[model samples]
Target: MSDNPMPSSFDGNPEFKEETAGQKLRRRLREEPLIPLGCAATSYALYRAYRSMKAKDSVELNRMFRARIYAQAFTLLAVVAGGMYYKNERQQRKEFERALEARKQQEKRDAWLRELEIRDKEDRDWRERHAAIEAAAKEAAKGGPRPAPAAAASAMASDQSRTAEAPVEVSEEKKKGGVLDAVKSLLSGGK
Candidate 1:
């Protein structure tokens, strides 16, 4: 085995070496600090102090103290304002997320309802087709005996009669007599 590493084919590829100026700038910016608030606050405080001391009088000391106090107050206010803004932004983000979730749920519900409606319509159509086929079968059966339209009507009537005459078995417990018999026995004298 050789101690030297094998050269990859991509080493000679021109596409790997291609990079635009904008890409390089973006890479540099990404590597830089994101927020420079520390430097900005220090610079602002120093500038305010410099302006406050510029006045040369006994009142200048008072003004400098007041300016310093004002600077402190402003710094505190800015901190508080920034905190409140961030809190409000977070709340707004939560509300937007909730609204998006609710919209998704509503869309899912609507899709389900549409699917159910389509299924119901298909079921109704199937039942209607089945009934028509049954009617046609009956007509054809009757026409086998007599080749007239009246025979089909007679066959339908016969089918209705046969269905009506079919005996329906009722259980002894459900013969509509259990409760009534008990009531009757109670009304009678210990029968």
Candidate 2:
């Protein structure tokens, strides 16, 4: 049979398939056929030798025995050659498998790198927003004119946009004191 299975209506058992003896022989002939032929020849020669012995024919018995030995030798050679062919076939299959596995691993690494790049971008944006807020608070503390209330509302709107899909996870730096501490410092003005 070919390396791939042939689709069929019969999905009964994956391990078993129904086929007549003739069909089986035809399939065998399509793959390493010489070994099967050699085995058949050996079996026939042995059968004839047994028959000749039973008939009390010494000359025919000797000839059949010699034929059986020759057939057995041919079968042995055929088996060794088939083994060598299969070894090469198995090596090729292993190489194909290794290459497939390597490709999958590379895809996984690429995906991980992409995720890291996104996280880095988010972290940079978070830091820039905090720095802008701190600067505004410092200016207000020094008795400068405050930013318009609408500007504060727009900043809040931008924060909400970042959480459109889900809550923004607190990053490593945010986990130290957090946005609450920043808000407190802004309202209290270092007191």
Candidate 3:
């Protein structure tokens, strides 16, 4: 009813006097482009990082970090233990092989010593029997008393073959042929 138009509802509110978000942003970009550009870049980086985040809750984040740490520690421990175990096993195996070799050498020496002892006993026995035979022959040449038949027979019976000085006929083993002959023999079924 008045000559002047009534004031709008927007004009009555003080909140409408404040600059809008888009107006403020445009004024900041136009007035100081470098600072706003730097701020925008930093904000964008933070936004991207937030968007790419896997764990939302602090509890979940802590659990994920703990699990990763535990897995890495376990893997490291297993690698170190495995390496030490292999090294220790190799050392033990080497020691065992060395001990086995020493034992085999000792066994060979023992066998050789036994063989020598047997040879020495045989030689001594043969010498004593030879001396007895020589004495008996000398007594016969000197027309001395003869040995008792029963005693002489009993003494000679145990080793009569060994006491004899007859010529020995040694049979030699046949020499093996080369690979070609062996193959040929095999092809011919051992002929």
Candidate 4:
């Protein structure tokens, strides 16, 4: 006879086997049925699904955080650029206002200068006309109607002298030489 043991028919047919040690323990645990083993298995599977969802949520949160940071940076850049542009515009406006004020002041000054110039010209013309009238009056005062040719010539010569108003005769003592006159005389004598 062979020394080998016979192979059982149950080992060849896996579906016809009795409960194992582990299956017996599980059945004993499920006897009270506080929470069935199947329910516990499903709860554990749902917990694993929740953990996967939490991980995906964390990835999305990180992407949102990066986008927020980029948005903040761009907002800061826009604010600074707008502030600079406003400052430049304000300065330009101030310069334009200053130029306008200067132009107004210049126009006022020019108007004043033109007025003074016109007044001065009018004064000069009036003085010239007055002097002409005075000379004609003096000529009419000096003569009778039509003197002799020789007398008329002499009278005309006298009239010329009278018409040219004589320099005011200051006293000789008042007309004493100044320091400049003395120096000029001394220099001329030496020469």
- Model 2 lDDT on a 0 to 1 scale: 0.67
Model 1, global lDDT: 0.52
Tell me the lDDT of model 1 at 191.
75
lDDT (tens digit, per residue) of candidate 4 on 1-191: 52222234323544332456897567645443433433454455455556656778766555555554555555566556555656854465455546556656767765765454444444444565568556656776886344356864575566456434433222421254333334445646945
TM-score for candidate 2, please give it. 0.40
Give the per-residue lDDT of model 2 (tens digit) for 92-175. 545554554665676775576545544544555678778978888999999888999899879867865773544434464345
Indicate the worst ten consecutive residues by lDDT in candidate 3.
Answer: 167-176
Show model 4 residue runs off by greater than 4 Å: 1-85, 144-191
- Runs of candidate 3 with Cα error greater than 4 angstroms are 1-85, 148-150, 157-191
Q: How good is model 1 by TM-score?
A: 0.33
lDDT of 1 by residue, 1-191 (tens): 53222224324544233346897566534433222343355456556557656755446556555655656666566666655656854465455546556656767765765454444444444565568657777877887433456875675566556445543223432353344334435646657
Over 4 Å off, model 2: 1-83, 156-191
How much is the lDDT of residue 10 in candidate 2?
26
For each candidate, the alpha-carbon lDDT, in order, equals: 0.52, 0.67, 0.54, 0.50
